[model samples]
Target: MAQSIYLGLMSGTSFDGVDGVAVQFVPGQPLQVLAASARSFEPALREALFALQTPGHNEIEREAQIANQLAHDYALTTNELLQQAALKPSQVQALGVHGQTIRHQPTLGYTRQINNPARLAELTSIDVVADFRSRDIAAGGQGAPLVCAFHAVQFGAPDETRVICNIGGISNITILAAEETTGGFDCGPGNALLDYWANLHLGTPYDTNGCFALSGKVNENLLHTLLAGHYFALPPPKSTGRELFNSAWLNIRLEKFDTLPPQDVQATLTALTAHSIARAIAQFASRCQAIYVCGGGARNPALMQMLGAALSTAGLAHATLSTTDTLGVPAQQVEACAFAWLAMRCVTRAPGNLPSVTGAAGPRVLGALYPR
Candidate 1:
């Protein structure tokens, strides 16, 4: 196969910002990241997005406006990526953009990502690939953890089992077993709840290096309450988003601990993420030798420390944990690159979803193309 350049744009469930990358993929060689750029969502836009996570009045109009706004943000970031890479729109093959997902409910046979791909294409003057999840949902799959297929290509080991744990707003693990097919699913809440609490108590977008969490101790009672959620115990081929683990959900669970110290709550939330992820690894990828983490959660030292302890408790004491930066990809950029890889597959007419990972009826090409 010949080499081609594709740009990828992503705004994860964290609703924090847009991350864009210009990447070149060549046959038999590791993919090269030409350029990367990130732009945070303005406070107003971020609030609007968080509000839309739940049902609200005038949602159709609100969501449409937000989609338009998101396309503009995506285009701006894409332009920055292109400029940084010293490439023009005409030189790029296409853009793979994963829009802001407002609701991910594959069980209900629908998933919604707010995006205006045509507008993005018009703004950027390049072919655009968007709406990557619905097709998998149509095929009876979770329509998520889509990054696992990309993980298998970029991080898989032939002689040893590896786990790629991506902790975005929601945490998910991709199991790349040396002797078995790849598997993954949403493990549980990631930075979403932690960030929410941080924003609420500290007036910051996220806890810097988990300092708020490190200042307190994990309350086992609250931790037990969190672990008892039905989602954590569900088998694989399942996924979740803010739809289930949002502020409202956390508030309800916090009613019993109203007098609990805010810092303790933060700490428990961090532990919740660590324990849930550790449980998933133990249950599905018990034999995994090393776990390479990606996404925003990798930056949190407290969370990482908690994860290490949680792993020891889960009987995965021998498993080592580290960030994907050691694997030639920055934690924040893996998902963006994954979508770029996915877009390449779509452009080549190859299947993108792995039936084993997503429980899709079969592999399916996963994106909608909008030509410039």
Candidate 2:
């Protein structure tokens, strides 16, 4: 039997960069991470992609250009990882590229992740698995937070309940409790609001260690207001993005506190992220015994502190808080490896979406394959 190796690529909600991972998964065996790389989009392109996430005029042409550039950039990173791994295109099974999610409206029955799979396949000379969300959406699923299945597979504990959290531009969690069906959903904003607020004031992309936010105190009123978002109130099997929580949304809420210090507002946003996730965990997975965080937010210490504080106050003070790295997978590589796992599943004709997690009609083999 040949080794089953798949390359996974992910450009998360933050649009900060694409994380490419190459892994080999032999059936019934632990997957091995072979190589990984991170490639960032140029600032101008990043802004354009961010703009397209929301409504605006003259978007069609701009979006097309952006998609092409994204594919080109994805190929660049994929090629680099392949070279570093010293593997030929033929040796790898396929590439799973989660294109930039410009819009995800599963309720209305459509989700858009803009990536030219055909072009990517042509450039990489490898089979491509893309559009991993639409099929699940068609089956009445939220079609977001698609990585929970991967989390359940990689991090599920036999004795203790484990919560796997990926905090990108948006935040989400996977609850893997022993003997209980694994489940997860988008908790809320992860770094989106904080980054927006920081750029608007500190002129940086994200809060390093949540320093700006640490400098200010959380405004109880603003925290309360931000928590009132309708999406947060939705039941499980739900997902969200910049569509509901972005700079514009933040700006609208900020108008009332025009005189508030920028750092205070940033602090409030960070708290909103922490409070929302902690609240979700408490409400959905009260039995959670440990939390393993991943993605960009794991690097933010102040935010982690707030999460710990919130969780401790909720009477779960003994639950351990840490990143996925403690479990062998690096924080940033988990999502990328997830896409790789999804690609391998698709190639093997295995189901990807967990009906219980996404509220889909049934389990389905997610992602459309574009052959090279």
lDDT winner: 1
What are the lDDT figures for the candidates, one per model? 0.94, 0.91
Prediction 2 TM-score vs. true = 0.98
TM-score of 1: 0.99
lDDT, model 2, position 286:
87
In candidate 1, position 356 carries an lDDT of: 87
For each candidate, give its TM-score against the true structure: 0.99, 0.98
* Top TM-score model: 1
Clashes of each: 0, 0
14-73 per-residue lDDT for model 1 (tens digits): 999998889999998888999999899999999999989889999999999999999999
Q: After superposition, how far is residue 176 of candidate 2 from its true place, in Å?
A: 0.2
Go through the candidates in order and give the C-alpha RMSD of each one to the true structure: 0.8, 1.2
